[model samples]
Target chain A: MLNKVVIFGVGLIGGSFARSLRKAGAVREIVGVGRSATSMARAKELGIIDAIGVSGAAADGALPLADALHGADLVLLAAPVAQTEAILASIAPHLQAGTVVTDAGSTKSDVVASARRALGSKVAQFVPGHPIAGRETNGPDAAIDNLYVGKKVVLTALAENSETDVERVAAAWRACDAIIHRLTPEEHDKVFAAVSHLPHLLAYALVDDIARKPHADLLFQYAASGFRDFTRIAGSSPEMWRDISLANQPALLAELDAYMAQLTVLRAQLAANDGAGLEQVYSNAQHARHQWITAIEAAETPPSPDKAD
Target chain B: MLNKVVIFGVGLIGGSFARSLRKAGAVREIVGVGRSATSMARAKELGIIDAIGVSGAAADGALPLADALHGADLVLLAAPVAQTEAILASIAPHLQAGTVVTDAGSTKSDVVASARRALGSKVAQFVPGHPIAGRETNGPDAAIDNLYVGKKVVLTALAENSETDVERVAAAWRACDAIIHRLTPEEHDKVFAAVSHLPHLLAYALVDDIARKPHADLLFQYAASGFRDFTRIAGSSPEMWRDISLANQPALLAELDAYMAQLTVLRAQLAANDGAGLEQVYSNAQHARHQWITAIEAAETPPSPDKAD
Candidate 1:
């Protein structure tokens, strides 16, 4: 049975996985690695991991990629995208032949490419995955063990991904009670561009637009719950969004163009005082949102009123 | 000692006022008027008012606008903007000479104009007000007594407004726990156009943009808390938003133009793959949002753990 797991970049997602896995009693040990001592200390305090390691010691420990492949069963990559390629390359020589590796990166294709280039023989064992769960809050402190309980986790894998690797990755998420959705790396990027990346971009854009206005402070005050919801993602880490936008430029730009086009159409209609047209569009969107929300709620784990914690 | 209160349009705003006043024991024998039987029924169910009256009774029973409006101590016009002029015109001759006639319209100037034309002498008693609250959800069923608590209720009255009229209107809102921000009609519309109306238009535009995308379903699925928050306003009653946009057109259009310019700059930066420039904008927006939120929390009510029922 896969027991011990080493999670890189023990921040929000990584720490969350550790906590959930521990809560589910699905892991014997979790070794967390990160640069910040505070993160490492917090991870331990939160019981997110059984042990914490900083720098090289964690990198070269017994479950050191190759050694871990021998003993620790899974390696979860949650580091920043820019550092991912280097980490994959550094650990490539140490991976055990059949050891399965997975990632929780927001973007997929690049990670897949890095995996194939860094670990040739082990390419079949690497599955790229992203859990669609987060909050305006971040860090290990923000990690909620049940964050992914009913959330969708997309796994982007190539045809070459071994059945064993896919199952292992899927099993890991199932332990967290996450619903699994499978797709190709290309499909994953395109899909996320519209749903995730595009929304974040629009939010950032809207907030920026308002921020530059003279009465921005009052605007923010008058910013009802709707504005708050729309701009919440704007508060995300700039470094993360920077990488995401650049990595998925083509898809994001395409979405942006499409969004701008729709805006132009709506603007013109409003300029002409076309109430009918505006109402039709609003009704359609309202219907779509209602249906979407209903579906999501239906997919939720049966309500446990006491589960707020 | 004002015993009888007449509230026109027994919908969300009107219903909320009824509940608040009743709860505070500020008014007796409250009468509600709405064309829709369903809304009138809901108002009764919610205990919004003591009686439901047909248009004539609610509009003209309380006070005759000319000859020192007598019976109604307070009359609140809570109807749509397009209907505001006619409603005021119809009730003008009946308003008691001393009765304080106010409105809860989003756009103040137009309502003020209606007041001036409809009741030349009573114009001084006409206080145009808008409480910066209300949900995307609407109708009497959505009304709650606490809606105005901690909300900014802007009252726009001319310099000629009688002290008695202004004080009475101000006292009404204070009983409902609102912070009054007094401004002129023109200034109220201009400031709101920037802070409220423009944001709503942008949200609707974005929603329309997303709805038109090929992968709209997928895109919307990944819409995080931010997109939801931002677009929440877009789901408001079509009739209400139409009135707001049209009534506050000049200022809203100017704000829209400014936003479009900002969007164009961002689009150019994206097309050029200018990561640094993109990051700069994102960082600036993040900082602005942070500062804005901080200030809002400081100025407004504390973030409620349990939102208004």
Candidate 2:
């Protein structure tokens, strides 16, 4: 079991990690470090963390990061992507030699680079990872112990990371009931840019386009389940999406350009009144979508354990 | 109560309408008419229809449209948009003078025009309509009795329609507990093109792009809830969407162009690393989305029922 784990941002992802570790009895003495006192207090009251620690220096009512990280076994920089470097820089000096650091950032390559810049040689202890489990909700109260159960958590291992340290990180995730996959940091970023980042951008853009129209209220009134499901991701936090979009720019922009090309082809077909061509593109998409959904359902299904029953 | 109704397509929307009318005891002797005998037989077995009628002519052991339309109060063309002209043309000769014909096509302007071209003076008895309820699932087996409860259904009344005929159509929808809105056919087409048609096209394009890649399996495996929500519409029927895209070409094309312009702005922001600009767009979208969803929720909420409870 891990002892004395410190979490830099005790919001949804970090708070859920703390709760999961606690539920599994896999960690002892969880401490939260963040800039917000009210959020930390809520996390404390919710028992998501055992202590509230201030970030920079010692203070009257809070435990400083120096003291919090003194005996820590792990540190998770679960804050926004833009803050990765700064959080790492502050935590690196006091990090115990055996302490392992990781992150729950959506994009990996940028996080990996930030770790290298801030932690210097200590970057070996930082195993960059992303949990592919997300809801449109946020904050500590939204956290739950089983958030990662049956979900995929990706670890983009660095060459500098020792095998032992990487294994320790994997073991911690396993304790939370997450299935882990390994990929190079660049590969992880590209995959997510297509699957996650591009979809969000598309949803946000669609919503903004409709909302800016003079007849928006009338349009929204007529929108049915299809529009609701299609724009569901547009309800996600803007600041968070902004940081993700900017951090994964190259990969995301490439995916966006490809998607535009696809739309362009579709527009041409529409302009030409080519029902057959539109059907071809739609058929391909519908077929692949069906295959993917079926695969996911199969993977999520449990084995027949009660044949007798 | 209405007597002797005919439904041309015994699928999700058609079946749902038949079921709802039957459930409310608002119609007598619902008859199913379609090209697929198997589907019509299934509708007969499911009790969604009382009689199976042949569309084109008298057939072996089947009721012909000439017999089915005798003294029929209504004929609802709950079929694909592309079939509007042909169905109306086929049924026009057999249509009783008192019969009020309506449609459940997603697009309205084309359906209205098709009705006018086929029905001539009978166009006065043909009321153009669009029930804004849809599901990805189809066929007789997917029918439900309460499908339109509290959902919006738009009736685009023609100048040729008598006030009494329009009222009769409105009464039928009210019997199914659907809220009725009246819009001109042009307004209905434009509003839906922005809200429903555009989103569906966007979803299909995004899925086709990612699924055609060599690493499609890997990308699909990593797709989480956000991706699932965003592309849910991509799972819709290809033939149905193709018909919709072609039938509503003008309005949908305008929407598609405006959407592309929005995407171009987003791509430039990404290329320039403009986080603030992206955040501004995202924040505006998130705010409007929040407002729209909240308003929908409020509208859907029933009057402070159970103050005593």
Judging by DockQ against the true structure, name the best candidate. Answer: 2
TM-score of candidate 1's A chain against the true A chain: 0.87
lDDT, candidate 1, B204-223, per-residue tens: 76676667667677666666
Measured against the true structure, the TM-scores of the candidates, in listed sequence, are: 0.88, 0.96
Model 1 residue runs over 4 Å out of place are A41-47, A50-72, A120-122, A141-144, A301-309, B37-70, B116-122, B136-144, B220-226, B299-309
lDDT of 2 at B112: 82
Among all candidates shown, the one with the greatest TM-score: 2
In model 2, where do residues sit more than 4 Å from their true spots?
A: A305-309, B305-309
**DockQ, per-model, please?**
0.51, 0.88
DockQ of 2: 0.88
